[model samples]
Target: MLDNAKYDQINPPSRLLMGPGPINADPRVLRAMASQLVGQYDPAMTGYMNEVMALYRGVFKTENPWTLLVDGTSRAGIEAVLLSVIRPGDKVLVPVFGRFGHLLCEIARRCRAEVHIIEAPWGEVFSPDQIEDAVKRVRPRVLLTVQGDTSTTMLQPLEQLGEICRRYDALFYTDATASLGGNALESDAWGLDAVSAGLQKCLGGPSGSAPVTLSARCEAVIRSRKCVEEGIRTAEHRDGDDEMIYSNYFDLGMIMDYWGPERLNHHTEATSMLFAARECARLLLEEGLDAAIERHKLHGGAMLAGIDAMGLEVFGDRRHRMNNVLGVVIPTGLDGEQVRQMMLNDFAIEIGTSFGPLKGKIWRIGTMGYNARKDCVMQTLSALEGVLNRLGFAGPRGAGLQAAWDHYQREQPS
Candidate 1:
């Protein structure tokens, strides 16, 4: 038996998000999403789509022609790249630093690639020699890794791996979902073959759009596997020479055609997500990518200092931590989840928990996107101080706030 229930108008609590991701989006981005929709192939909509391509190229620091959006979360973009490029039994080498690295390995395996993984401890990242050595040993067709793994709060250095891949004639793909905009990533300059990122992090937008870029080499590999759907095929068009892509929605070649000059229909574009992505990039470019990254740096530094002043140990290698998030080691004799709940229920604040081996061991604090501000950092630190004190975990009462204030003060022009 079914009972009909009436739902009330949408109203949600306002929370200051200080977690690993899904951070508060810029209000400007939300406004852009609210703009009225246009037809999928309407000249105006196509025009907006083209503009989005150009804007994301700037955001990714790449000149690749295949740069475009996947109409889903960050993971969708990653899958689109992997499923399109990886063939059955093709060798792929993955260097796992954290949970997202494991995700890459899992996706590649599902794509039927003969995945080989070399791992570093959770809190650390791999060295180039280590990766190069694995590449030499496996001689894989593709090398997949994550630029930043939010689970471990580690940003893997990618600058040297590209040249190494080139030496072996292997494609290099990195998931940059956790590090773009707020951190340094030069796709063209670093020689990455494919890169994917999401709007929910440093891009200051919601989670629906994933911006991806592919080098000519990577595009060529994906194009080889392209096949037109029977419904959309015309007599003039023949199926691609290679195997048909496994996933209809994730076929990059078809997606490329949709975003390309051909404008072949695939799926109705997620117009609102596109608008949000465009505005996110527009705002970053307007401020200058370097300045936006520096803003993240300033605020992220303050948060770290405040955590230190609170007598909390920061997790992982400080040298390799991402600019927008930090991992604070959970204190002994205190319930980590309880602290998180008190902060949420009392202060209207939200932070994140760890996963896998790190579960209940640390909390991930983020200063990213729209919430990367002095005030946000100060408020978060103050709330955390109060929570810790109430839990009978005493530290210098005002020390965290003072440390953050001191950092901001010193950053002032002398």
Candidate 2:
């Protein structure tokens, strides 16, 4: 047995997070989390919860009445929806483009659903026809996929897939953790039956809370699995005839009751996380969702121009890439990890590495949420130039920063 050691106060060095996600939380969102807590059922607390639901509907660009927060990270929202709606042996079709698509299949399998998969090469996305062909063959009860898979820096085109799912009578579900807020995702217009996302990305908050919205059809499927708790039962012979949702904690039906007008309790709300999520949506709406997406596009275009000027190859198909992140191919003869280390240790910056196939071959740079700004872009490009030069990876000295500057200048109104 080892003795416990004393630790210092919770101060950590400042970092410019230009990695895949969990970017720096906005100052306003941090302040929101620092506010005092109240009882779970306090009138003010429920009122705040209701306000959050309404705010996320605006963020999601949906009028779905079932929008609410899940008290865990992004995956919690994904699992809650999948588990609540999928009975054992139900079929789920997952199209794999990157790591997160595999994650969806694993989660569905755990729900004891029959998981089917189709794969696209990494650094690319699926065509709606390809997915439609699979749906025609399998006829899955759900067509589940990711909107943006950061592992390959690709955003799947979801617009037409919704119509395909509707034609096949399959529920269209997506985990938008990497694409929401700073990207265009129209829930109702896209015919997305269920949508889930975390505050850690373009919404500009810390991780731990997930915001979700459900179309009316998706809500009905979950409602059919409701099993009220023994203690809270008023006059229940059990509401739904279908098998009860397996996991008590992730039961979306029960979570709905908690967030619904009845004001029932599933568990104590994750109060601080709720505050962070609320402020995240508030900040995005304050800026206007379309405007926020445009901001990401502007900064992302600058970053892309800078990377190209630096003579580095981007990993994915540029036409389908996400606006907030990119995968930069690491040139041969230099260690990618060493370059990342120097950027972190010396310049106080952080970038990410690719996963699976692209691992050790590319550097994933991000400009998302609070860190997506002109200064952050210029500083990161400049510092990267210095790091590459020091590592003996020869490139034009100041071209990257100059390219980024020129791009930004062109975008500014005359």
Candidate 3:
């Protein structure tokens, strides 16, 4: 029989989120999200919108004026960038190294793009020459890839790809969801034409908002697909003659008008998420973006050291790994799910299982966002040690925590 029970007001368990994403949001970001709402056209609301745009410019390390929030999770930003510029049958080249790369290909195919792909093994990223060779062969209209793929715990080197795309007359884009705030991503300096990221990772915010930036070239292509909604159309409103975007909500051109000086009504913005995104950027900028990235590197390295000392093998190339997350191979004789369940049920901590090809092979642990701290690292490592020991997974007792402390001590102990 179904237990049709009434639940009390929103009580929830407190668990340290040490997984790949959706970690505990920063307290400051939560406070910002709790603020009262205002009308979309309210001066204060519009001012906040403008400030969000400016703040994300710094967060994304770009001077492009199109930097703004997409009022959905990270993939919405990816869709917006892809569907805005990709015409039916337009050639798009995607390099697949992990699950999210497959996501990029899927989104592009839905946009009616003639998608081409180059791939690497799950734990490896494509080299510049490999991508350049594909670009030269495909002569694609756009080249899309992921900056960090949490599924395999690898970060593709993007600094050189941008220049390669330009040299080959192809536009460049990357989904920076797993890496943006915790890793080094130089949007303008790297020649990136489009970059999209979510606030849930190293920004220490919830997962609703996605911030995106576009170079002038990318913006021009989007403007070519511009179509103002009939209800809000003014005499001065002009529609671009190119292909109309399939998605009304994901349309970047109309969204630009919504966020631009025109103050055009597209969709009612998610006010709380806007506040959260703003606060996330404000917090990051206050800490200095470089400093925050270094902090992730610090905690991430400590976690890696602890895992390694416990005799767990990291799943990918160490040189190309993102500083925020890593994949630990499940021990030979233990069920991965049992270990994760014990960590959660007994220790009140949360970590992630891998996806796609890596599914059932590894556990993805993250040191990012508000949870990227020494205490969190030590606690998670220690708890996993306890779980593994009880399950008869062998490694030295107390060694993991000691190794993590030694790493902190050797670097910058505070």
Q: What residue pairs clash in candidate 1, if any at all?
A: none
lDDT of 3 by residue, 109-183 (tens): 898899999999999999899999999999999999999999998999998998898898899999999999999
Candidate 1: list runs displaced more than 4 Å.
1-6, 228-242
Which one is best on lDDT?
1
RMSD to truth, every model: 2.5, 2.6, 2.9
The positional error of residue 103 in candidate 3, measured at the CA in angstroms, is 0.5
TM-scores across all candidates?
Answer: 0.96, 0.96, 0.96
Model 1, 293: alpha-carbon shift in Å? Answer: 0.8
Q: Candidate 1 on 1-414: residue-level lDDT in tens?
A: 544455556788999999999999999999999999999999999999999999999999999988999999999999999999998789999999899999999999898889999999999999999999999999999999999899999999999989999999999999999999999999999999999999999998999999999999998888777455754654434444335576889999999999999999899999999999999999999999999999999999999999999999999999999999999999999999999999999999999998999999999999999999998999999999999999999898999999998999888555
- Backbone clash tally for model 1? 0
Q: How do these models rank on lDDT, best leading?
A: 1, 3, 2
Residues 190-256 of candidate 2 have per-residue lDDT tens digits of 9999999999988889989989999999998988775645535434434432356767889998899
**Model 2: lDDT of residue 273:** 97
Q: Candidate 1: global Cα-lDDT? A: 0.93
Roughly what TM-score does model 1 have, to 2 decimal places?
0.96
